[model samples]
Target chain A: EAGVAQSPRYKIIEKRQSVAFWCNPISGHATLYWYQQILGQGPKLLIQFQNNGVVDDSQLPKDRFSAERLKGVDSTLKIQPAKLEDSAVYLCASSPRGGGGNEQFFGPGTRLTVL
Target chain B: DQQVKQNSPSLSVQEGRISILNCDYTNSMFDYFLWYKKYPAEGPTFLISISSIKDKNEDGRFTVFLNKSAKHLSLHIVPSQPGDSAVYFCAARGFSGNTGKLIFGQGTTLQVKP
Candidate 1:
């Protein structure tokens, strides 16, 4: 079985520029998530989608960050006018369903560098 | 407020010894806990998990112990090998309706020397 897939394994952009990251979760997965992992820190959830419907986005920066899962299969996370602090690895993960103890499968995150 | 924390940033252990990585969480509503291992430039992979109802869960050589009263959890790797060197993260899930989003702690880096 194929694991989660993400594009643009690495990205470099200047501050104040716009950037976007994409993610394609495993087949038949019902839950998708986007997380931001700064250096030396664990991942923080930015947004979560349950079959195309957003379930949680409390930690997301509404002013600059936005995410969408049109068909619930693939997702896109965007940051406008990126800041230096926005430089981090954007990881995408998915699970079979929303429940306790369900293991999440992660993708090779996109390393974003904002200069 | 940081809900989950791993006080130790790094630890070194000799091969064939046991490596214990500790983590503490502040939220009492957290009902499930998990451990994830990550390598440089790669996403975290699930290692083990334990429910709040249970104090211990073991899988192969990996074991996780949870102390709900203290809000502390730990991961233990026996007979540590060089391959076990990586960053381990602790995650917790709160009982917030249908949202199962996990809150993670700062990772602990383990270095096992032969």
Candidate 2:
């Protein structure tokens, strides 16, 4: 079975520029998630989508970050006016369901470097 | 607040020895715990998981032990191989008022020498 797929793999952008990352979840997966992993830190949940509907995005910075899963199969995360602090790896993950106790499958991630 | 924490940043062990990674969580509502292995430039892969009701779960040479009373958990690898060298992350599920989100630790980088 194929795992979650992400685009770019690596990206570089200047501060104040806009950047977008794409994610395609595993086949038949019902839940998708976006996370940010800074250097030396664990992945931090940015947003979650359950079949095109947002399940949770409380930790996301509404002022600069936004994410959407329009058709439920693919999703995109965008950051506008990127700051130096936005330099981190963006990971996408999927699961069979959106409930607890299910293991999430992760993608290779997009490493974003904001200069 | 950081709910989950891995105090050790790195560990080194010889091949065929035992590798123990520890994790502590402050939240009592976590219903599930998981360990993920990650290599440089690669995403984390699910290694093993254990539910709160079960104290121990083993898969191959990897064993996870949970202590609810102390809110601590550990991942043990026996006869560790060189391929086992990677960053191990401890994650917990079931945050109150959250929807199936996982809280992860800083991770511990393990090195198994040949």
Candidate 3:
């Protein structure tokens, strides 16, 4: 089976600009997630989607970040008026249903660099 | 607050030696623990996992030991090889219905010398 796929392995944008990242999870996976990994830190969960519905997004910055999983197969994460602090790698992962020790499969991730 | 913590930022060990990485978690709700290995420019891959019900889990050269009383878990690699040089992250799963969301700790970078 193929792994999770993401677009634009790398991106560069200016401060106050807008940027979007897209992710296509593995086929038949029911859960998807987006995370941000800053330099020298662990990846922080930004949002999680179970099928077409959101399961958790409490840590996400509502003012500037938003994400959606349109048909439960693919998802997109957007950041408007990007800040310098937002410069980090955005990772996407997917897992099967029922969640009984199912390991998540991660994508290559989009490395966003905000100048 | 950082629920999970990996105190060591980096470790270096000679090949064929033993490597031990430690992690501590403050939350008692975490019922499952996992370890992931990551290479530069690549996403993390699942290495091993252990449920709170079990104190230890081993696969090949990688072994994970959990101590519920101390709220600590550790990964030990025997006969470490240069290919094992990478960042290792510890993650925990909380019991919140079907969320299955994992809380991760800051990773430890391991360098194995030949």
Candidate 4:
């Protein structure tokens, strides 16, 4: 079975510029997540979606970050007026369903470098 | 306050030796814990998991032990291989009001020498 897929694999933008990352989760997966992983740190959950509805986004920077899962199968995370601290890898993961104990499969992630 | 913590930043062990990675969490409501392995330039891959109802779970050469009272967990890999060299992360799932998200700990980098 194919795993989660992410686009660009790498990105670079100026501090004031905007950037977007795309993700396509595994087939038949019902839960999708977006995480920000700074260098030397673990991936931090920025947002989670159960189908087309958002399940959690408390840790997300509401001022500059936003994400959406249009059809509940694919997701996009965007950051506007990016800052240097946002220069981290954007990871996407998905699980079989929105349930505990299910292992999440992750994508290669997009390394965003903001100057 | 950090909910999850991995005190050891790195560990090195010889091939065929046992490797143990420790993680501690402050949240007692976390019911499901997991371990993920990640290589450079790659996203974390799920390695093993344990539920609160159980104290130990094993998968082949990998084992996870959870101590509920202390809110601590450890991942053990026996006869370690060079391929196991990577960063390991521990995550927990719990509900905070209306949201249920996995809280991750700082990773522990492991190197296996031949």
**Each candidate's DockQ:** 0.73, 0.70, 0.60, 0.67
Per-residue C-alpha lDDT of model 3 across residues B6-110, encoded as one tens digit per residue: 999999999999999999999998889999899988888889999999999999999999999999999999989999999999998875676667888999999
TM-score of the first chain alone, every candidate: 0.97, 0.97, 0.95, 0.96
Structure candidate 1, residue pairs in collision = none
List candidate 3 stretches off by more than 4 Å.
A98-102
Q: Cα miss at A20, model 2 (Å)?
A: 0.3
Interface RMSD, all models, one decimal each? 1.6, 1.7, 2.0, 1.8
lDDT accuracy of residue B57 in candidate 4: 99
Across A42-111, the per-residue lDDT of candidate 4 in tens digits comes to: 8898998999898788889999999999977899999998999999999999988765345688999999
| TM, every model | 0.97, 0.98, 0.97, 0.96
Per-residue alpha-carbon lDDT of model 4 for B3-108, expressed as tens digits?
Answer: 9999999999999999999999998989899999999988888899999999999999999999999899999999899999999999999886755678899899
Tell me the tens digit of each residue's lDDT in model 3 across A1-115: 8999998899999999999999999999998999999988888889888899988888899999999999899999999989999999999999886252437888989999999
lDDT of candidate 1 over A17-58, digit per residue (tens): 999999999999989999999998899999888999988889
List the candidate 1 regions with Cα displacement exceeding 4 Å. Answer: none
lDDT by residue for model 1 (B1-114), tens: 899999999999999999999999999988899999999878899999998999999999999999989999999999899999999999998755777778899999999999
Looking at model 1, how many pairs of residues clash?
Answer: 0
How far off is residue B35 in model 1, in Å?
Answer: 0.2
- Write down the worst ten-residue block by lDDT for model 4 chain A: A96-105
